[model samples]
Target chain A: MDEIKEIMLDILEEMTGEPMVKEDLDLNLLEEGLLDSLDYVTLQLEIEDRFGVLLPPSEYTKEELDTPRRIIDVIADKMAV
Target chain B: MSVRFYDGFEFFVLAAILSAPAIWLGVTERRIRGYGIFASIVVILFVLKDSPKSILLLAAYLAYELLLVRLLLYLRSRGKAGKGIGRLVIALALLPLILSKLAEQLNIGGFAILGLSYMTFKSVQVIIEIGDGIISDVDTADYVYFNLFFPTILCGPIDRSRRFSADADSVMPKSEYLQLLGDAMTRFMTGVLYKFVFANLLALAGTDRPYIYGVYMFFDFAGYSLMAIGLGNIWGIKTPDNFNKPWLSVDMRDFWNRWHITLSTWLRDFVFSRLLRSCMRAKLLGGDRVYQACMCLMANMLVMGVWHGLSANYIAYGLYHGVLLALTELYQKKSGFYKRHKNETAYKAVSWFITMNLVMLGFEIFAGHII
Candidate 1:
């Protein structure tokens, strides 16, 4: 779980080109403009590459994956399944 | 003497009278699904009775879509569902809407039916989801009710089959139903003000200017959407909202999220996302993400434009917004200045002003003023 969190944060920081802190986990990535639709597509592709989990865009809404923490949790859940 | 949904005060009064029993059932905490379905049938028939051609077309369209859905379900159940067949089925589902749009473009009559565009959205969504295996079963009555729910039969907040069925199948507790009713009443009244008062005033005052016309469009469409949502609530269907604080949007992308929300989201999920997924998987454009994004955005918006009509003006409007959105994407992704000052209040205000003008320009193109 800790490894997954670290990896997720790294991916987000790489995408946004800014260092992310633990406190930023709860921030709304979309609402804050840290991510756009294109970035979101990239993130999903990266997740599948790294975590081997598929998050169908139709099944999972943007709201469901809005925050870094939420993305991590969803990835974890999918991995568990 | 064809009666249109929500056309006048007389329509609302008649609808209210016809819905009395369903409303009573809802208030008493009884299952209103049966009565709701019954009311929907009566309302649809009454609204289309004078237009025999429309009635026949609607009935035929419904049967055709239902058969396609059932066939798809059967294929899925038998584990014979494949990509080739799925695509064909979806095209078949969209045939009527495509022909209707084409016929309208050629100035041919009798091919179009009331609410055909909105109904196609619902039917196509169901068919796609079923192909995705997310939706395995579809109840016939629930399907008909979702398509012909009289409140949204003309325009729509485009309720999904799964969400609609969930609400339609459940009996809300009295307290919950009351709260929904309260909210519904508020939305309905607000819609009345927006449509009957503000929209009419704007129309009378003049929509000669692009910005004024854009605002008029917002109030008029949003007003209709609100009333439909409110009425849906009374019937226990939590129809999604069509507009947010759209005028406050700071960019073209943000505007889409805040305006005509259902249609935009529908396109995003069904069209844009799928296009991107396929392209990315194939590593199209040699994995040039920005170019791929721009291409998808253009195609998505073109579909939107063509959906409105095959006219040059509508196509130009769609293309205009598509270019604006693509340019916005390119700038945000590639510009160093934007990266540095994007978070500043001054920058955001300037962005908002620019985006507003661009949106108004697009609306002008849509209204055939600039094209």
Candidate 2:
């Protein structure tokens, strides 16, 4: 979980050009402008490459995978399944 | 007769006279709603003067959007909003703009409305955001203001509702107002220089026709955007910029980011992102993500192109850039050489030269030089 979290944060920072703190994990990524659709796509690619878990982009929404917390949990569930 | 620098001069004088009270209110008390309202009226009148029939077209379009949005909201309040409903609402919102473009192509001649494309973009955004539950509170007055904000009425930086309203409703301190005043003056003056002097000189440049025309257009459009941003600042609306130093871009994607910054960003957010997501979910490209992305890029750019006009050249220009962007992405991904040499000065210069020529060729196509 921590490794996934680290990878996601690194991608977020790269995409947004801003650092992400722990508190940012719970915030609405889209609303806060921390992530956009393009960034979301890039993040998904990064996640798939790292975890070997392919999360279909259309199967989720910005609202669904909006935060680092939510994203990590979703990935964990997908992996479990 | 199109509006010119001389008319712009008169417009400034007239606008100052009409908006004096609003300007005073901002300076003395920081109030802006009165200014916003007055500014909206001025633009409406200005546009009406340009083409009186546009008023009717605008009214009908606005009526359609407002009714559709309210209806969607009511349905959502009743817990009836679903993906199908959302798609339907977006389609309806797009109908007028689509029809206007189609009518122009067919020479039907009556469907044209000033700023219809920008209005459609804003309306679609409102519906999508509302459907997403991102925006729950919709004020009629604010929506109207966003629709007809004077500076961006014709060509736009396409300010978002939430961002626009925040600036629209805020009270800037006297110090900040003074700073804003200085900034506005600088932008206005620079815009005037770009449009009248530099662009006009380039237009005169039988020195080399195609090269001059391409670069001239950059100045002309950038000048207009700067003027709009300047006026917007004075009116207390923080209109976002549309251009950066686009000539310096090293790739198609980089060029897009710098040139027409707002439109490209809008298409990325609202069009490409959504299209890509849907394709991925449907497994449309048979699990090859790169191929999927390439197809999505073509689709997205083609839509953007058609938005300019339903013409062969425009579509080709869009497809050209789409292919270039996709190929650039593929190269960046596959070529380890790019990763190593990308940071070097000589490599960057060579890349920039290729990107600019490609962009110039696209502009030539857009200018209807071919077909």
DockQ of predictions, in order shown: 0.55, 0.19
TM-score of 1: 0.94
Q: Pick the candidate with the highest TM-score.
A: 1
Model 2 chain A poorest ten-residue lDDT run: A54-63
Per-residue alpha-carbon lDDT of candidate 2 for residues A1-81, written as tens digits (9 for 90 to 100): 677677767766776666654547787777575664556776766777788886644345457788778988888887777
The segments of candidate 1 whose C-alpha lies over 4 angstroms from its true place after superposition are A1-10, A17-25, A50-53, A73-81
Cα lDDT for residue B333, candidate 2: 58
Interface RMSD of the candidates, in order: 1.5, 6.3
In candidate 2, which residue ranges exceed 4 Å CA deviation? A1-39, A42-81, B1-8, B50-52, B206-208
| Candidate 1 structure quality by residue, lDDT tens digits, A1-81 | 999999999889889776753568888887676787778778878998999886656666788888898999988888887
True-structure Cα RMSD, model 2? 6.0
| Model 2, C-alpha of B10: deviation from truth (Å) | 3.5
Best by DockQ: 1
Least well predicted 10-residue stretch by lDDT in candidate 2 chain B:
B1-10
